[model samples]
Target: MELYQLRTFVAVARAGHLTRAAEGLHVSQPAVSAHIKALEDELGVALFTRSARGMGLTPQGQALLARAQSVLEQAEELTRAARSLRQQLDGELKIALNTDAEFLRVRELLSVLRAEHPALGVHLPQNMSHFIAEEVRAGSLDGGFVYGEAPPQGLEAVPLCSFRLVVIGPLAWRERLAGATWADLAREPWVWYSDALPCHASVQRWIAPYECRLSKVAVTDYEGTIRALVQSGAGLGIMREDEGARCEGAGEAFVWRGDSLPMNAYFLYRRDRESDPAMRAVLAALRAVWGLEQPLASAHMRA
Candidate 1:
């Protein structure tokens, strides 16, 4: 029933183990266990099933996990709101990035924000797209650029750029695909991403049946590695048209830009944090750089 209990519970649920969660929270194993036991006793339901392998959330636990996350998120937001009310733009502007495109925008945004809003500080937290979304919602990030099908719940997504996806291959691929269709990309050896990455699921669908038997010369989470593998004669891989242009083999990189595989890059933040003056200036700087300085239309997002 205490805040620490809930925090411990959330950490355990996220880590799916007591020892790891305890280490992350800087607490002892018994302390974590006691907190969970106390929480379960108060709630009158078991949250996790203890086992030799590891802890697994029960049906009740899964149900509580959602509400627990929301509660913890809101609690942190409350603290941030109070802090923002008392002090304006004094803290770091915590931002997150996922893809290379998102990462590329940071230096520019930081330089502009610093020159314009000298009172404000900036922090970059490089992580996957999903974590970027989650941290923004949890008030751990002031703003960030995330790539996904849609925005995370309770956060506004300001569309910055939209790029066309392409299936990229080396110069030699041009000879084999004299007249190739979207389906033809599936027939070749595929070098795909692992998981929890941008466009992984879409890449899977694009490669379809061939993904089962296709040789995965490089299973990488790094975009640079994928590009390197493709350039080093590994196999065909998925990339954005802009990304392909910046990498090697720009002239002979077999690109399928006609496939309308578009993804919207978004700058995300908590809905309540929009009124912060420093945050506004940071956003304005970005808009000025991107030629979107004109007032943005009112948008209330729900994932």
Candidate 2:
């Protein structure tokens, strides 16, 4: 029932292991168990079902978890609200991003938000797609920018932009095989991204027919690092067009623009706290800055 207990519950839900969650909270496993027990007793429902592997949320646990998270979020907001009683919009906004490249749109959005809502403080953290979505759902992050196939469960998605992937490589290497299909590219040494990323999954599918035989000499999880490595003569790699352009002049970076891959960037917000003024302003700023080509409805279909 206490705020700290709710936090413990949320962490346990996310980690799916009481011991791991306890470690993350820097507390003993007993303490974590006590907190969950207290919470479940107060609610008169079983919050989790435990097995040898870890913990899993029961149907009732899922429902209460959502409500508990919202309650904890609002409790923190109340503390901030008391301090900002003199102003309506003065508060910190924590936003998480899936990648560093997302800064392109974030910068444009923040510029307008700062101009109009000067009292609002903004904090941005760039992370992988899944992590960003997890933070948003846990209420640690107010909202976030994630680019991928779909939103994580329990979060709402708003399309910001739709872009495709391109293969970039050193000019000399590209010149050797200027117009290569997925099959042809499969024959060369390539830099592979980790499977956790959306782009990596796309690449796997694109080259699935060839069975990933294209010498994966180097493997990286970071887009920026992979781009840099590919430019440093590692091998051909996939990247967004704008990201490739930013490093084109410095490194051996050039977009092939031949492969048409679907990539959709979305703004994710917790469903329970979607009506917060800060979140609304951020959404408006995003749409205005991006000059959203079409309505969110249409964008969703293509995304």
Candidate 3:
């Protein structure tokens, strides 16, 4: 019945946890419960089921989520339109910068948004690729830039660019890494990514089925950290070609430059947010930052 109740329902469903949804909504848990109860009673169907870990949506709740999100978005748009009629266009969006903000042309993205929507407020937070995807899907973040083979569930991903990921090491090890094979690289002590990082699996796939156990000298998830360790002769590491080249030119490191691995970059957001004008504007700005409109027009996207 009430828009507030519907919002609470949507938040609960998205978070799959009552407390988290309550915190995100900036309301007390009891209030969140009351809202959910009222909505369920009004609709004559149970919307959630309780479990030890959290609350989960029932089939009925799942069915209503899309419709609820659409209603909320439309209502928000109506309010924005009314404000626009008065010559004011106010908006605030939270965006995640996956891995490192430096790698994604972040300044360009901001410039585009500022030019189009001067009143729009933007927040950038550093986050992992997988976490960024999850936050975007849960409506916590507007969108994020990530590198991967594909986007996760409930998201729409558009290709931004493709680049080579290269194996790199300290310049001092140039002789050691030369003509190194997968088996040789694996046998050498290396700077490796933590198992939890999204890039970890991709790095493994880069040398598919090699099944060689790397002698990990240092483990980390941060790209800058990995580069630093690799350049310090901590061991070998995999990184973007441009980054490796920069380090090589600095006389700090050497890129393998043998067979390079390819990685695709993409911008990800929830499909439900597609109808949002601000989100649409953000998407356009992102594409523009990549130097074209619909640059990934033919790129694959998950439904």
* Best-performing candidate as measured by lDDT: 3
Instruction: Output the worst ten-in-a-row residue range by lDDT, candidate 2.
Output: 294-303
lDDT of 2 at 141: 92
Residue lDDT tens for model 2, 62-109: 988898899988998999877665545778999887777445567777
Q: Kindly list the per-residue Cα lDDT of model 1 for residues 80-110, writing each as its tens digit.
A: 8777556545667777777763535767777
What candidate 3 gets wrong by more than 4 Å, as runs, is 1-88, 294-303
Whole-model lDDT for model 1 versus the true structure? Answer: 0.75
Query: What Cα-based lDDT does every candidate model obtain?
Result: 0.75, 0.78, 0.82
The TM-score between candidate 2 and the true structure equals 0.63
lDDT of 3: 0.82
For 127-180, candidate 3 gives per-residue lDDT tens digits of 778788888878899888777765565678877788888899878879876988
Ranking by TM-score: 3, 2, 1
**Which residue ranges in model 2 land beyond 4 Å of their true spot?**
1-87, 101-103, 245-251, 293-303
The TM-scores of all predictions, comma-separated, are 0.62, 0.63, 0.67
Quickly count the clashes in candidate 2: 0
Candidate 1 is scored at a TM of: 0.62
lDDT of 2 at 155: 75
